[model samples]
Target chain A: MDKEKYAKLEQKISPKPPLLKNVIKAFLVGGTICLIAQFIALFYMTFFNFTERTASNPTVATMIFISMLLTGFGVYKKIGQVGGAGGAVPITGFGNAVVSAAIEHKSEGFVLGVGSNIFKLAGSVIVFGVFSAFLVALVKTILVKMGVVSW
Target chain B: MFSIYITSFIVGGLICVIGQLLFDVAKLTPAHTLCILVVTGSVLDGLGLYEPLIDFAGTGATIPITSFGNALTHGALAEAEKHGLIGVLTGMFEVTSSGISAAILFGFIASFIFKPKGSV
Candidate 1:
């Protein structure tokens, strides 16, 4: 078949995604994840000496830990399948990515497989996160010294 | 308190919806999207723009990966104020150490206990 005909045929066969439904699912799932994190933060604030800002650190850590556990049990994959970006926009998504990679490559042995491959998905996040922060700080420092803008 | 929950829910939900649109319409890879968000977050935080959003939305802003980048920048800047040049070296990771360490540690343990479904 000609290229145009082949493209039309492929389009006919492929299933269209339910875009609106998927968006609602993602919205609900993502909102729920944030709600859980907020609850944890509030718990820390009320029960401990942590203020709202300080409570966030532990809240994030706890979310990551819980997501990692869920990823191990393979529940997170299901959540990802259903939630799409909803499953990925949170820090829990980062946890799921890292743990899933490590789990997927576990049989190649610990050091090379789990250790090296674990960061495959999330390494870029860490690298760019740190790099961008450094660049911004460098600029801020220079601008402050130059008296162009003062914090 | 209730307003905080509603604001957080709506903001967080909107961010996720935007991310989904990027994935579906723009065809950006998740990794690329993640990198973009983190960088954008850091830049906004540096420019003093993100703090206001965080103030308005609370965990809605803080729960996203962007906020993690914002937190890193905030920590680095605070450290730089106290320690000067040396802070640039130590600040980013120092502030994020807890989250990173937890991710790595939990990931390792999970890997140890669970086996892959099949060899690729």
Candidate 2:
């Protein structure tokens, strides 16, 4: 029965590609995200004495925040609609993921319902990311100490 | 500079191509695929394999799910280092709150005005 179900499912094709409107919306929304990052980079460079090279980190940080805000307000869904993954795939889009998930689950309550679970998807991603990077950084630090690598 | 640009363009395009193939050819939802990509990117980055790819490809590597993971990790670490235990939560938000707020605010406004239609 499972094999037959799998076979039947595999044979189906979506009637069309994701809608053109969605693609364009994604393009515009995604492009807007990039533009915001550029602005943040420029701002850091101009006001904080950060070099062009150093400003990228802050820019990425800013983009994530903006996407989070957008997700909360619900504009990203529109963008996601028009943009599909185009709108939903960027760093800001990741923000949308966390916030939207929280919003979806918000009816549960505040502490566990909204506050703790608000950033569920994003939180997991961050946890894994930080832990993994720590391991990498540790290896690099050890290697550098041993003169096997240089920063 | 020209060579760098060319390399980034090609690599970014390739990354998108693979992502697209995963979307169109494979049987995964976009979010699921993105989650997988982000995790994969983070692991590769953790192994230090992704850094070189990032140096070479710039936007290609930076534009995907992995980049998101990298940012989260970087933010959390920075926060934790500065404030100890409390910094973990504060760090994540402090690092990302602005952009996240911006995204949510604008997304909310847009949704309110435009009423985007789709299944979540």
Candidate 3:
């Protein structure tokens, strides 16, 4: 550990998660999430007559929704104990963030407290990402219009 | 195809190994290391140098947080073309919504039960 960097990082508020467990959790949770998604897709294909390709998207959406529900119910916490970032970095993790924030502040009243801040940190990140992409796209369009480069 | 899969697995493993070395042996912090790898990958990709690596590795490149940033950039750029200045937000969220949704759902669940033991 770099003393200087450690000192600096230590000042920041974050969990001191166990490395091995988190890594294992990430692998297991991430894989399991993917496996569950595959199962959903297979089920859709088998019962509903959806094509494999067609089944993929709805399966993903369903997975995210289920993940959100889990996060709302606090079951993901148990998964996180084993999966860490493997669980946290996936789409399900994002759902957890918004819902959890809402749950945390639900006492403030649904609209102002829970609903308003539901996106909170994750919202900002998405917003920033979207905004920045728009700017870049605009520039590219302007350049393209001016015959600067071909798409 | 089999060779490609094997190569991807190896290269992806190597990236993790390098990440581990950086975390365990180097003086650099995890965020810093992650940042460096992602930025390096992005810059190389922007310069058209990383495509071959991506082709060979697939998820090796996409699994990293930096790839997430690249996806955001690509999404924003694509949307901005359609929606003018507003595309930034539109493009980014549209492309990444699935991932974001997933993250939020899981994060929410974890937070409720584990309560994150620490503060932001």
lDDT of each: 0.84, 0.55, 0.54
The per-prediction CA RMSD against the true structure, in angstroms, equals 2.4, 6.3, 7.2
* Docking model 1 quality class: medium
Judging by lDDT, tell me the better candidate of 2 and 3. Answer: 2
Q: Per-residue alpha-carbon lDDT of model 1 for A1-151, expressed as tens digits?
A: 9999999999899876677887898899888898888888889998999986777778888999999878877788888888888898888998988899988888888998899999999999989999999988878876876889876
* Per-residue C-alpha lDDT of model 3 across residues B1-120, encoded as one tens digit per residue: 345444544554455545444544464653455554544544443333444664665444444344445566666566666776566556665544556555545544444543322321
Best-fitting candidate, scored by lDDT: 1
Better of 2 and 3 by DockQ: 2
lDDT of 1 by residue, B1-117 (tens): 678788888888887887777777677888887888888889998999988987777788888888878878877887777787567657877666767888898899989788655
Q: Which candidate model has the greater TM-score, 2 or 3? A: 2
Q: How well does chain A score by TM in each candidate?
A: 0.89, 0.68, 0.69
Model 3 chain A: which ten-residue window has the lowest total lDDT? Answer: A124-133
Ranking by lDDT: 1, 2, 3
**Alpha-carbon error at A110 in model 3, in Å?**
1.0
